[model samples]
Target: MLFHFMSPLALSNSYFLAFRPREEKSQPRLSTPRFSSQRTLFLTENNQKKLPFFQARHHWMEDYKYLFKVVLVGNAGVGKTCLVRKFTQGIFPPGQSATIGVDFMIKTVKVGNDKIKLQIWDTAGQERFRSITQSYYRSAHAIVLVYDVSCQPSFDCLPEWLGEIESYANRRVLKILVGNKVDKGDEREVPERIGRDFSDVNHFDYFLETSALDATNVDQLFEQVATRLTNDMKITDERVHQYRADATNSSSNQGGPIKLIDRAQTQLNSCCSRQ
Candidate 1:
């Protein structure tokens, strides 16, 4: 039921052990305390509890919290959706349809001992969706800017896309410039040299030519983002999600819910250029 947001960009492994408050029914007076790591969710007499953040179970709702907001953007046909789809679902969404105004999805991945929740937002690449969609960029811990390796126009639009993310989205957004559609190597219009040069001079976190079609290096891109967020200053939800409202109406113009994966179905889901 997992959806790969874009084939080139990955949402990597995250491990979260939630600590919750549970009371033991069996009462026994003992000088020493008991420790069991076997229990997936646990509680202690002390004021602490643990739960797995990604798994939505009855006990976890009261314990775990959202960790990070991960956002993705690019031109309409640049494979943004494909890259995510491939990484999350392991299979791309079949066929293609423009992501309406916006799309929301979340996947929890592990970073070392702690599990970090990744809130993924995939927006419409079309220019018309810009106003309605740019709002997703704010509060994003990481912003993935994508472009098609085979298309000139999409590649040319990198700066404007980067600027939009910078000005409107999270000002401190971590960026990865993706040169997608590397499978179309023969058809490439933007040379790797140019893409590499721009990424280097701009000091982008990372850049690579990837093929969502082949599922290449998609996961690596996200791993880098996760590492940055975990190692850098850890920002909390209040400062980031203060503006995002979930209690409001479903169809409101503002950002809303995370689309949970339905077990029955799935899709195949890249991009490049930065300046």
Candidate 2:
């Protein structure tokens, strides 16, 4: 699962690690730690305890706080492959062939001391693969819709892609629009303003212009995805924690159901006041 691919800028390697999807049947539970004379534990930013640095390698594989599935979709030859390659492998695949059905990669990134594992799916853009790609949308935590800046047809077909996304993706999935091939300077057909405008009109969570060839804004694109998803998940975790606390307190007062509504209303009011 390791390959050496050469780009004009440098020689780099891309790794396609063999990944097994984490089981969803049971959630991982953190238990109170028991101190041992032979072992030491360190606290993460979120106060999760872990093995000390020297013995953490084995634990690191499962150390992530969250796992996000990020799928890239757009028309064929739009450089979706290149963008993923550049960010994960630091290589601009020269004359890269169109992705067949799907290319998958795994990368672990840190968002403010929390480890986030990104499961990246680089999907084919050909019409023939449309059915297959749509299946991935529903389970994705985020979707990146890419277009080539030099290709007008690719830009024009965005609506078709958006339609497919709307039909298949989760309603709350993070949506990102990326305009690739910014290296095609003079040949650019899609202006930055036009891309931003489309993103706004279509309610994209974020928009970015990137040049996989030169690595412009390439890393930033995926970093933003991780940061946004992590933040959103943290907020959700907080609400769940609040609900549990309220339920526990309610049982003591025999006001279980009513307290839940009151807690939710208080949270809503607090959010509105902040806004």
Q: After superposition, how far is residue 63 of candidate 1 from its true place, in Å?
A: 8.2
Off by over 4 Å in 2: 1-61, 255-275
Identify the candidate with maximal lDDT. 2
Candidate 2 lDDT over 10-102, as tens digits, reads: 101111111212432232222221212112222221125445554453353356767667889999999998888888888988899988777
Clashes of each: 38, 0
In order of appearance, the predictions have TM-scores of 0.63, 0.74
**TM-score, predicted candidate 1 vs. hidden true structure:** 0.63
Candidate 2 lDDT (Cα, 0 to 1) = 0.71
